[model samples]
Target: MYPHPHALEAVAVLRVAELLREAERERRLPRTSLRRRLAYWLRAWAEKLEAPNSQLGYA
Candidate 1:
């Protein structure tokens, strides 16, 4: 069944509000180390590539 148009609008507004709050939280967080940043990128890459856990290496 389809949702009411107003409900979809409300959901979009809520999501935008949550995203704004998340951005604010990120701005307040401490700077990450180079190694930590590298690990994060590696993890994201592995996920995107659908690589196996064994191939993730030192990350």
Candidate 2:
């Protein structure tokens, strides 16, 4: 069965978010920058899901 496009995008976004958060916690990313990057990625992912043909690229 084919998965819903939005569901797939959501899973992808969540997985990325988890990885980003982990990296941040591990000190791989700067604390102040982490928040900005996370918010950017999350918003881009949501936009991509809502607009399948949009040209936004994932991080």
Instruction: Give the top-scoring candidate (lDDT).
Output: 2
For model 1, residues 1-59, the per-residue Cα lDDT tens digits are 99666555445544544554465468754456864575455445444334344342321
lDDT tens string, model 2, 1-59? 99656566777886776677678679897668768777678866765755756454332
TM-score of model 2 vs. true structure: 0.54
Q: Rate the local accuracy (lDDT) of all candidates.
A: 0.49, 0.67
User: Per-residue error at 4 for model 1, in Å?
Assistant: 0.9
Q: Candidate 1's error at 35, in angstroms?
A: 32
Candidate 1 clashes: the total is 0
Off by over 4 Å in 1: 28-59
- What is the Cα-based lDDT of residue 5 in candidate 1? 64
